[model samples]
Target: MRLSRFVSAASAFLLTAALALTGSGPAHAAGPVYVALGDSYAAGVGSGSYDDSRGGCYRSLRAYPRLWANAHTPSGFSFTACSGADTTDVIKRQLGPLNASTTLVSITAGGNDAGFVGVMTTCLLNSSSACLRRIDRARDYIENRLPARLDALYDAIGSRAPAARVVVVGYPHFYKLGTSCIGLGASKRRAINDAADLLDTVTAKRAADHGFAFGDVRGTFAGHEICAGPAWLHNLTLPVYESYHPTASGQSGGYLPVFTAAV
Candidate 1:
C-alpha cells in the first residue's frame, strides 16, 4: 500500500477574506490563477535549460511552477519569480505584479538572504568543518532575521492578492556529504540539513501566523538527499553544474508530492 502523506489544510475563508479587495464569485471570473515568487529554486535553475535570452535564470516547462500551472489548467499564470531574489527582492519586485484574481501563490526564498549559494559552494569543495563553522555563526540570523523577512513578504502578498492561498516552500539539501559524491563529510551534511530545517521552521511558523500553508520539501527529499540513496542533485562532480541544485526528476518525483499535498 502507498503510504499516506500528511497535508496541512487552511480555510479558503482565511485567504478569501484577506483578499476581499479583489471582489467575488463567478462575477469575479473563471480559470485557475497563480503568481509565482522567489529565487533560482522557484525559477527552475539547474533542473533544465533556462531561456538564455531571459538571462541565466533557466526556467523550464517542467519547473514546479509550470507543473503547477499545468495541473491547474484553464487558469492563467503570472510568473514574476526571478533566479536570485532574496526576501527584499520578492517584496519589492515580485509582489507588485500579483493581483487579487490570483488564487495560488508559491514562493521559495531566503537562501539568497544569507548568500546561501556561496556557503554551499565553500562547504562542498573546501574543508567541510571550516565551512560549517562559518555558516553556524549565522544560525541566529536564520532563526530570527528570516522570520521577520518572511513576515514582511506575507504582508506584501496580502496587500496585493489578499485571497490567494500562499504556499511558502523550503530549500532542499544540496549535498549528501561523507558518501563521497564530492568528498563532503557527514558533519557538513548535518549542518546543511540543520540550515534547511531552520528555514523550514521559520517559514512554517510565519505561514501559520498569516493563515497560509508551508510546503515541507525537506522531509520528502530525505534518504534521497545529496550523496545518499538517489542523490537529487548533480554538478557536485561536474563541469555541468557548478552550483549544487536538484535534478529534473527530483523536482517532479520528490517535490511534486509535497506541493500537491499542500494544494
Candidate 2:
C-alpha cells in the first residue's frame, strides 16, 4: 500500500511538471451559441439555394450564417434573418431566439430600411435625375429616422442577449465608379455608391455606440463591385428580388471571411 501511494504521488507530480513545461491544461470552454439576425443580406438573398422549409423568408443554405455554423459547429445556431426584414421586423420577430446563452450574433439591416433597393430600381428604369432624387430621399430617411430605429433594435438585442458578442455587419458598395458600365450612366452609379457609403457610415456609427463589432465587408468586396470585371453582386436577374444583392461567391468569399474574422 505504501509503495502504491508513493508511485501514484510521483506520477501526479511528473504530470503536473510536464503540463507546466508544455503550457497545456485540461480545461475546455463550451462551444459558442450563435444566432444570425438581420435582413436579406443576412438571409443570403442573391446567393440562391433557398430552403423551401423556411417559406417566404428566402433563407439560403449558402448564407454566411450557415457557413459560420457549419465551419464552427457551434453548440447552437438559430438562423432567423428574413429576406425583407427591417429594424421593425427584427424587433417584432427576430429577437425570439436570442438569450443570455447566446455567445455570438450577426445582423445586416438598414439597407432595406434606407430603401437602397428602391434607389437601385429607380436608377435602373428612370432618368439619371430621377434616380438621384430618389437616392436623396433615401439618404434623408437614413440620416433622420433610421438612427432611432437602429438604436431601438440594438437596444432590444442587448436586452435579449446581453452576454452575446453582437456583430453588426454593414453592406458593400454596389458599383465601381469611373467604369464604363452599360446599364446606368456613370453619374448615376457614382450617386448610388455615394449613398451606399453614407448608409454604411451611419450603420457603423450606431453599431459602435451599442458596443457591437461592425463587420464592414466593404474591404473584402472592394474589387468585386458591379462593373469591376467579374462582380460578386447581381446586376439584374430573372428573379427580380435577387437584383442588387450579393452572389453566392460574395456570401462565401466576401461575407464569410469578414464574419469569421469578426467572430
Candidate 3:
C-alpha cells in the first residue's frame, strides 16, 4: 500500500510539471508576448537599414521597438506597424498580431488621420496664410473628430488584448523651441510645433481615458530637432519617402529611452 501511494504521488507531481512546461498551469507559466502597432513613426520610416522581410513597412533594425525587444528579450514579438498606415489601417490590418496572449503593446498613430503630411507640405510649399489655414483645419479636425476615433481604437485594442500594457507614443516637434533654420518663417515654425503639441495632447488624454500610458517624446527630442546643432530627425530626403522621419540616432537615443521608461 505504501509503494502504491508513493507512485500515485510521483505521478501527480510529474503531471503538474508537465502542465507548467506546456504553459497550461497558470498565468505565471506563460512567457512575455509583445506586439507593436501603428504607422510610419512606429515603423522607423526615416531610420536607415530597413528590414527587407517587412517590405514597404520600412521597419529598421535600430527602431525603438527592436531596441526595446533586444533589451527585454520577450518570448514572442509581433511587429505589424507599417509606413503610411492610418488609424483605420491599424484597425483593419495591424490588430491581427494582438490577442489575449499579448502582454505589451506600443503604438504611434493619429498623425496621418490628422493630415500631418498635407499640413507639412502646405506649410513648406505654400504661402504663410495658406499654411495657417491648413493648420487651422487640421487642428479643428483633431479637436472635433479625433477624440471619438481614438476612443474607439483604444477600446478595440483593450478588448483584443485585455491584459496588455498599452503605450501610446507621441510625435516630436520638428524644429527647435525657438529656432527655424530651414528657411521657414518663425510663425510657420511655431505653428507646426503647436500642431504637434496639440496632437500629443489629444493622444495623451485619449490614452489616459483607456488606462494606457502615453509616451510623450517632445522632451526627448528637445535639443535634437531638425534645426538643432546635431539634428536627430531627417531634414528632407530626395526620395521624399524618408523625409521628416526620425534618424537612427533619434530612434536609439530619443525614442528608445522614453519607451523603455514607459514600459
Candidate 4:
C-alpha cells in the first residue's frame, strides 16, 4: 500500500508541474499587437519610400511602426496611418475592429486640420515673413480646434479597445534655432516650431486625460531641428521639399525611444 501510494503522489506532482509550465508561458510568447493610427507623421510621409499600393499617403515599410515591429520580433503590427487624416478620420476609420488584444496604439494627427501643408507650400511662393503669418494663423486654428478633436478621438478609441494601451505622439519642433534663412528670417522658422509645440501640448494633455500615454517629441528635436543638425529633419530638400517634416533618419531616431519605452 505504501509503495502504491508513493507512485501515485509522484505522478500527481509531475502532472501539476507540467500544467503550470504550460499555462504560465513566456512574457512575450505571443508578441504584442500594435495598431498605429493618425495622419502624415504617423504615416511617415517624408521618411522612406511609401508603398504605392497603399495609396498616396506615403506609408513606408521602413517607417517607425515597422522599426518597432522589427525590434520586437514576432510583434504584430497594423499600420493604418493615412495622410491628411483628421481627428474624425482616426475615430471612424482606424478604431474599427480593434480590441483588448491590441497591445499598443499610437497617433500623430491634428496638423492637417490646421492646414499646415498648405501654409508650407505657400511659404515657397513668397517672402518668409508672409509665410510666418500663415503659421501664426494656423496655430490659432490648432489652439481652437485640436484639443477638443483629440479628446473626442481618445474617447472613441477607448470605447473600442478598453484594454489596449493607447499612446498619442506629439509632433517634433522643426527649423534651426539662432539661424536666419537666406530669404526667410530665423523668426519665421521659430514661429513654425512654436506652433508645432502648441499642437503637441494639446495632444499630450488629451492622451493623459484618457489614461493613455503621451510621447513628447518636441524638445527631443531641439539641436537636430530643421537645418540645425548636420543632417536630420529635412528642410527645403528633395523628398522633403519643406523644412516642416522629418527626414527618414530623423524619424527612426525620434520614433525609437518612444516605441521601445511604451511597449
Best by TM-score: 2
Better of 2 and 3 by lDDT: 2
> Which candidate would rank higher by TM-score, 2 or 4?
2
Q: Candidate 2, residues 21-139: lDDT per residue as tens digits?
A: 89797867778999999999999999999987988999999999999899999999999999999999999999899988999999899988998778888888999899999999999
171: Cα error in model 4, Å: 1.0
Q: Model 3 over residues 208-245: C-alpha lDDT tens digits?
A: 99999999988989899888978998877766988889
lDDT of each: 0.74, 0.92, 0.90, 0.76
Please give the RMSD to the true structure for each candidate, in Å. Answer: 12.6, 4.0, 3.8, 3.2
Q: Candidate 1 vs candidate 3: which has greater lDDT? A: 3
Model 1 lDDT-worst window of ten: 1-10
Ranking by lDDT: 2, 3, 4, 1
Lowest lDDT 10-mer window, candidate 4? Answer: 237-246
Clashing pairs in 4: none
> Model 2 clash pairs?
none
- Give the C-alpha lDDT of model 3: 0.90
List clashing residue pairs in candidate 1: 19-162, 19-163, 32-75, 40-83, 50-58, 176-227, 178-184
Give the TM-score comparing model 2 with the true structure, all chains together: 0.91
> What's the true lDDT of residue 69 in model 4?
75
Q: Is candidate 1 or candidate 2 better by TM-score?
A: 2
